[model samples]
Target: MKVKNIVRTVAAVAAGAMLIPLAACGGGTAADSGKTKITFLSWDNEQTMSPFIEEFEKENPDISIDFSYAPPTAEYIQTLQTRLVGNQAPDVFIITSENKNDLIDNGYVLDMTGKSYTEKLSQANKDFVSRDGKVYGQSISSWAAGIAYNKELLKQVGYDTVPSTWDEFLDLCKKLQDNGVSPYIEAIGDGADRIPDSFTGAILADKGIDVTTLASKDPQTPGANEKEAVKAWMKVYDEGYASRDNVGVSGDDAKTQFVNGQVAMYCTGAWDFSTFEQAGFDWGFAQIPALDKNHEQYAQGSPSPGLAIYSKLDGDKLKAAEKFLDFMVSDWSLEQRSKNGDAITVDGFESDVTEQYKDVYENNLKTGKYFLMTNFYSNPDVLISTNNAEVQQLVQGSITADQWAENIDAKMASAQ
Candidate 1:
């Protein structure tokens, strides 16, 4: 995972490409070096993936790995897409809601059904791995999305506990606002951001709807349940709870504001630990408040980062790729992940999460309430992108609740 090692590997690969014709004349395949090397392309930079890679290499001396990382989700997606199309894809890659379909549809990823690695996952973990009954990825962990609040802010508002009902939440927000604090701060510029934490929860609570199903539909003809979910989201706008100014706020901006004590609560995922730790405040986490008293306590999330093998790999290289992936889901890998604050998904591997966020992981464990965000589960990327823009506009007061919902519907339709 060292940057230098990565640079060397990439350089070697580039050089190999240039030498392909020469090597062809010399009558040696790239695999002729007598070692099985599986190239892994990760969205996580080299530093984060280094320890795990080291562990895998130490355990399997017969197989060597070369890793290349692209920046995060966006750049990684573009890079992998190009690589796959060019037949220069890495032997193993990270798969997520964003690029799973493209990989599966184009046959870039291997079908992992009945593989030994697939059997190691629990049934719940299996759900995200399969598409139309064909498995393509191994979901490593699960996460929860909700509110992270400053305990001091709640105390100032005369509350010892985070509100569980929308009504009380609004009242709390109003109190915080009166006290010269931004009651709630969220990244609303992208439809896929805030909705997953707030309105998406409301939608799940309202009708027991599965966001994935609705998102999978023709965007133009979003089901009645999906529309209702959008309506519930608008309630935040109607009540002046979430701000329209958030349209200008990036995720980093919102996190900074929350950490600096400018905001009382932030709606985001469990992954914001680094941000919260830097904030000089006493904080607590909780599930998204339920909609009314009848709604279940639901939050949005997805399987954490996971591994996929490229379909192009065959024979010994394919076997080595599969071995590395299996190593990733082993008990040791889970323990490493737990120690690193990863939420647990594989059965029998519990999280050793930090004390501050223990409640967050505990709630996810207890309720089994973790659900992937709508955009992650949906198709045509445009739906998620458009919805993100429209939601940001809605938060900024540039658009009405009806307009926001209409925009969502329009995007969904156009995608179809």
Candidate 2:
């Protein structure tokens, strides 16, 4: 919602203040030259979403989409929040881990609980945007983050593929380090650390702990299981398998190290494919090793943010918004999304992911063997920021793994 200040004359200014909205004016269902206009605020840029919008418009000639964009994460959240608070929100917008609670508690997004289009979503995709058995968003894809190891580097260490268990993985790291290779590097400078997150998933699965149930507990104790996971993950630093300096490394820095052959493995995901492909080396991606031989392999990931209809939308405009969501799950949209490199998770649709990432695609994404701490915890933004700071201290040996977990609990309790 753009507000323009117009002061053409002193007399007009003295009379009253007049504000006019610009191109970003379509808040709800507005008639655009006799056609119902459904406003949509997209996290994706126009280039990525335009083709679908055009196709949808062509399919339903009576409904026009007043599409707008804000880049993801911070800017997108702020833009949506501002619009929602100002009572000028779009008919449709994104629902993500960062804003799901607020959106639901405030009755901002419509429940897609019994919507036919929702029936086509994968269970994991449905659960990601769901709260208390009611679905709110149409999430259609997921991404997994795990170990990306250099094939040649691992070959030098006499390993054909990444091991499936944590102990063996550490042994391999030891071998790589003994051979003068920097063993492993994962960025812990921001967000929740992926290594620990994967370990937490494995632990949770082994213990049969339901994430949703854990999420419902008090915020102070929500991350209780994370203690064991963090303790296991700390072995990398405790045993000197990974560099303590990695606490300061950014994701790009870790990727750069791997690309430069300075590190044997980097903890990342498919987003690094193009850069890895251009690095002139044979690289392979694999799910993060299980917590132990008894545990299932898991990766750190979550479904992409989902599109949700505004709860206030009704009448022809609401119908138009629903149609737009239905089109997203249509065969054409799935195929296009697959082509665009999303690991499409809509039911009956298989993404043709690249071969290097096939391990993660098959083992983690397909089976829902992935976890994200922020996705399951309360005050997600606070959880991530606090976890990042606490984990950095754990890496620096300034605090024990147990202390890290305790700190996380205390921080979350205080935040609540």
Candidate 3:
């Protein structure tokens, strides 16, 4: 109990102070037996990511990945935002369409400006997660929503394949109905407000006029292109091509109908390939049959977001985090993703996707007929629930297509 004892205590406290900078899970990386530890938060469920994480850990034994998840869309974004603002976000996580810009603007996303991994990324991916060439995300895949068909159903209607052209598509729809099969079905559930809008957009894009390139903010108010596009979209419902039941349906319900043989075709994204694989029938993918022969195929699409780092990360930990991103786009990861029905899309990354989405990968993406709604208009909300309501009314005959166009312009104006 003398000065010597006090000095010893002081030295111990100072040594602990030197290691005060905290790491993940309330401890430093050194706590895990000298392995640099990093956390990865994802929108994907644990079941989907568990096996991948095990492989990643096996390949890089020096770095341990602590995976966490939240349901996609709103729940995921909200959880990530709350944690990041509280200075407790994961070392790496997904940068979704909803949270990408906000994360970048706040300087929360790391700038992999000169990293070798940034060199061979796709333009669509780069542009989405970058501001003026500073990359903040690693793109793993690109997705497009288009026409999916049941091959066997078409044969019963005297066709080997669905037709490509507005008139022919409609005629084919009629034939299927006459044969007691529902020709087409769409799930207009909330954010799934894309089917009709995609049709309208394709009609516009076919004529070399897209909403992104419009001379007027409200194309419908400015020219015949918008009006014609609306009419084309409405014609499907007006003439009973896609049944009215679509309005009451959700994506899962519509998919169920298609799988059960109640419908001949589905208008959806490639994400549905997994579910359709169990349909117990032959099926194939098709580009939204060129709006008509004159116009090439047009579909809705976007580059999928990827693993991003916290801007403040550095040292061996930062290096380890980069390794995870590299692994995400590596041939191994892409192959794993492709096997699960994803279309791999990193610039230099290649993997074999299922044949059902071959048309989307080979033809549609190359020709630029695939457009993300973000390119056309960035609405205030991600779901577009209001737009869905208006479209529902329009399809129900309570409103005209012109009124539908007006409602969207109003929403656009309100958002602006």
lDDT of each: 0.66, 0.81, 0.67
lDDT of 1 by residue, 58-107 (tens): 79867777777675555567667767767788788888767776777788
lDDT of 3 by residue, 136-219 (tens): 888766777777888899999898876777678889899988898888887865335444444555666655553433322542
Off by over 4 Å in 3: 1-35, 50-62, 131-134, 177-181, 189-193, 196-228, 270-279, 348-350, 365-369, 374-383
**Which of the numbered candidates is closest to the native, going by highest TM-score?**
2
RMSD of each candidate? 6.2, 6.6, 11.5
Deviation in Å, model 3, residue 151 alpha carbon: 3.5
lDDT: the better of candidates 1 and 2:
2
Candidate 1 residues lying further than 4 Å off, grouped into runs, are 1-33, 120-125, 175-182, 189-216, 219-226, 312-314, 365-368, 372-380
Q: What is the TM-score of each predicted model, taking all chains together?
A: 0.80, 0.90, 0.77
Shift of residue 57 alpha carbon in model 1, Å: 2.7
**Sorted by TM-score, highest first, which candidate order results?**
2, 1, 3
Question: Alpha-carbon error at 2 in model 3, in Å?
Answer: 68
Could you tell which candidate, 1 or 2, scores higher by TM-score? 2
Locate the minimum summed-lDDT window of 10 residues in model 3: 1-10
List model 2 lDDT by residue over 71-112, tens digit each.
566656767777898898889999988888889989999999
